[model samples]
Target: MIQTLPLALPGALVDTHRIDLSALYSTGWGVEAHDVAVAPNGEVYALYGVHRYTHGVADDEADPATANLGYRIITRYAADGEVLASAVCCPSDGDGDDSAVVNGGEMTLCVLPDGTLAISARPDCTTLVAPDLGQVLAAYDSNDRRPFEKFTPGDAFASSISVTPSGRLLCVTTEYGVWKYGNTLANVVGVADGPLTPASKPVIEAIASLDPAPTRYGEDDRRDHVRYQGDPVGFDHRPRPALTERLAGEDRLAGWRDSRLGRPVPLADDLFVLPVYGRTFRGGSRGRPFVFALVDDQGAMTGRLGGMDAWDDSPFTGFCFNVASDPHRGRAFHLNRYGLYAWDSSGTLRARLGTDTKTFKPLSRFTLATCSPAGELLLVHTTQHLVLRVPTPDDLADLAPAVEQALRTYARQRTALKSRWSPVNWHWTHTTTVHHL
Candidate 1:
């Protein structure tokens, strides 16, 4: 049987800028990935890590934090592919220790409104660096021996981070906990006092489906130790130490899941164009389940909006959602290993740019990135680490309320997307929470 796959007309996107992140990846004495970690904040795109510099110290002298090897760096670039600034992210631990600092563990990072950088790899370890990547601003650990909170190291692995419209820091861990920070540990106030549920309080009525819907990924992944307890998705997954102490009902295992979001990028003020926050257990299958969703001003899950075809199979190998920033109101782009798919607000494929046939482009990584209102916009940073902004595409404004409303409607009205799965066969219900903020 022959299938006609669609070809992506270049009109869907233009070659923007490519920057060489080699110098940034070089540890001078350690190692780094061939790929660069990029965060979009409107006009400039910041890539995590910086050049390997051996200027001040001898080859034998190593930074105390980086396993006593290389320097941790972060750099920001202007739209024209010019170097905005570069600074050490994981600096040497003071006291003349011969190792890299324990903050901002590795490749994971987020850019704050004030242009500050938050990077973390290990659980509960966060390092805040100045925008220029110049100096360390603040650092935090959940299980710090000095401050000793009741929290575990598991509570600090922030896989995702975003700032709400209100100058508050929002972070989510893979297993458990969602945290918001301002001055002190503000987890008890405002949005911090949340798993911000929907205000409308939609009525939820559980009913059996004419056709049984597919079960969630795993028993342990979604269910409690007994494998049948409570609604992991419906209820709040935040830490309840008392619940853990009791070791009794549904909250027995606490909260744990696979992928936290599709890709951690902001879609709008109170919205994000991302994938599902849950994942399959080790013994089950792996599916790339993505979704569009809304959040309250304080940043909490409001509802599940929709997109993508998970009917029969998954079309993505490697992918990224265009999480927007300031300066440019970039549209939402779904970049699979094959190419890019742009969607209209009405839950339909609008345009595509790239190859119809997979494996056509020999690119390891492709970010639906935007910066520089420059014509020569496409920037390519090669293995050689040359920072150059090549050229760009017109920033499309797509992610709107209408788009989410359409998807939300679709997820509700239709049992399956593109008739790939039967909705009537699935047992589903709406879950609600009290509005915190």
Candidate 2:
């Protein structure tokens, strides 16, 4: 049921497709990418699908928990059509054996200003692989290094993540409105500019807290690690997000048990752009309009950016992926099933790309898009196992933050041990950490 809706355009957008995925696409395999990002040198990278387990064992739940493995395959394509890097993801069976898995889906990803990829992977409850429940936020840096850190949010299902210019992380999760995390992934109540207060004081106490500490993980948590039969693993793939069960008579709160937010972007000194998605049937659903909101460093609502209904078309159901913001251009870009949309920092609509049916044929539940500085829009239609390109708006800023080249600085740490003088015969050991030079 693909419907073509008439869309207004500048006559500059020319859509084309590429089918040679170099084995990234095949029959019976599903693909998903929140956005396919283009690098400064024209390299394109994305978090794509890989078979759950090649060998060992299979459970009814394994079929659905593909994304839980983290960025199983960080696929990189050269501007000239070649596979650049084949980075590994997380694990599947007890044996490091993954020829393939059936019925896996797509994933959401964003690149840091320094070229690190941050992914939010929610385990599928239907395919109960492990009983222990939690969500994994994995980071992969530019050099194709292993996941440096896996931040587990005990109660929140992270939907999308973005990094600020100063190196802090920002994201939108299921239960909470929006959150900011430092490089260490610690939840912060404020930014460098000022202290942030909760929009609702009462709601602050009401919401379940972010996991004080990440779930314990071993060094081999990467997806490509070896496994075997009877290896220790969780059988429950079901999600166990903290639910807001009952609210005391606040109609403004409505029935929102968990607010499903889109990508959070830190735009200026204190202003940040937050894309608020409609949470129906647990988010990533269809025909729901996106409400754009603005907040200051204090996490207070400064104003409403308005809904993404500038065209006044149907409700936007497909979630926005790799949402790009151009502070220099004073605008941002969002791609969903409805089409590619350009809006100002104030959430004002500048243009509409197309509709779900008119854009391209979708094979999976999600679609991904990113822009090129050379007046090209590089997109990956995961469902169709294809790469696409279109002309960019003449005035659109190359605010492809993820794609820009950044001179990176890696932090080094020094560890030391301290011993407390024994009072009688008992000695206390303490570990001290020194950061930076």
Candidate 3:
């Protein structure tokens, strides 16, 4: 059952419904949705993909067509849970070729400050397609059938995309480096040869030069200096042994490891980059993945900075599928298995919110999160229901007393459990003896 909890004001609450999507579509069809965003007018849009899944049947069951194909779906919804628009972003089987897999549509969409929508798409296996402002918006409104500009020379996977305040669009993928689109998408699309610029070079050398090299010395090496305690050469100093040689081997190993790890690189004026460990299923492990730093335009990297770890080593950490700037706090917020972690404008971690474990509790397990233009929080929870107009700072503060009372109740329960099960208590021992009989 779905539950609704009221939050304190300046907050508006809305009820959510879990539509049984499986029944809405035909069998053998699969759907997965991601990259949800809310517009200034509170309209929500999401990118989804449809595929084929095989289900087992009994001997008596009727035979059915088993071939599976894939396509993409784009859906838009009003604030009041009304379906405003729906379109097939990519028609996978349009060519009627069974051997070829058709992957279409945009993986990432960004709404510019001027109310224009930008989509990053890979129309085929070997090209990157991004339509300009005029083209993108026209496609969104279904005014144009073709809106993508293809970069022919270089192939890229459209994994992620973002638009800067100045109107530059950055398209990125895990396998390929980043590409920049100028003020208009036309400039990049017109050049069919390849990326307008070459892939960014790794800045390993600059980071290595920032530190000084250590001097080498032997364990028995010693030095003596004349000391003038009262007068010139009045006091003589004994030779002191140098400690550098003793730690030379360890220091050299450490330096080598540090060098191999590489240093963080700056993507934009505020954004920085680092390499994070990624997941591996086989016995062998893959190299570390890249982590991008998200920062605000006015923020300085010297202080405020928040980072995204591609594959975090910490057991508590999980994959971050989406990240966005919170308009209310001016911080970058990301969704992870451990909940939402907030980072300042310069890409530094500010705070981590929500429960430690995944649960159906309110304000936890956010699959998709976005801050609307009006500064409201919209979350598509793990339950697959859209939650709109959640509480903000003032609303949380207003409910502080009630929230504290609930926490106190939880604390008391924990204390009672400890008292009942503690090894120091004799009752537990007595109970155990009775059970043995």
Q: Which prediction has the highest TM-score against the true structure? A: 2
lDDT of 2: 0.35
Give candidates' CA RMSD values in order.
17.7, 19.9, 20.9
lDDT per residue for candidate 1 within 1-437, as digits (tens), equals 00101111111111111112222334353223222333444334333332234455554554323223333444455433334544433334234233233443324555654566666554435556555555565554433321224423322323335444454444443322222111111111111212211121111111110001112212222212101123332123322321112212322232322223333333344444334322344563325343544333333444433344542223334323333232133334454444445443332444444444433242223333322222212222223222223222343333232232332443343332224322121211111111100
Name the regions of candidate 1 deviating beyond 4 angstroms: 1-71, 89-106, 122-124, 144-159, 164-170, 174-263, 277-288, 292-307, 311-316, 319-330, 344-348, 357-365, 368-437
TM-score of candidate 1 to 2 decimals: 0.47
Question: Which candidate would rank higher by lDDT, 2 or 3?
Answer: 2
After superposing candidate 3, which stretches have Cα over 4 Å from the reference?
A: 1-29, 55-67, 96-106, 122-159, 164-318, 327-329, 346-348, 357-364, 383-391, 394-437
Winner by TM-score between candidate 2 and candidate 1: 2
Q: Which prediction has the highest lDDT against the true structure?
A: 2
TM-score of 2: 0.48
Model 1: weakest 10-residue lDDT segment is 1-10
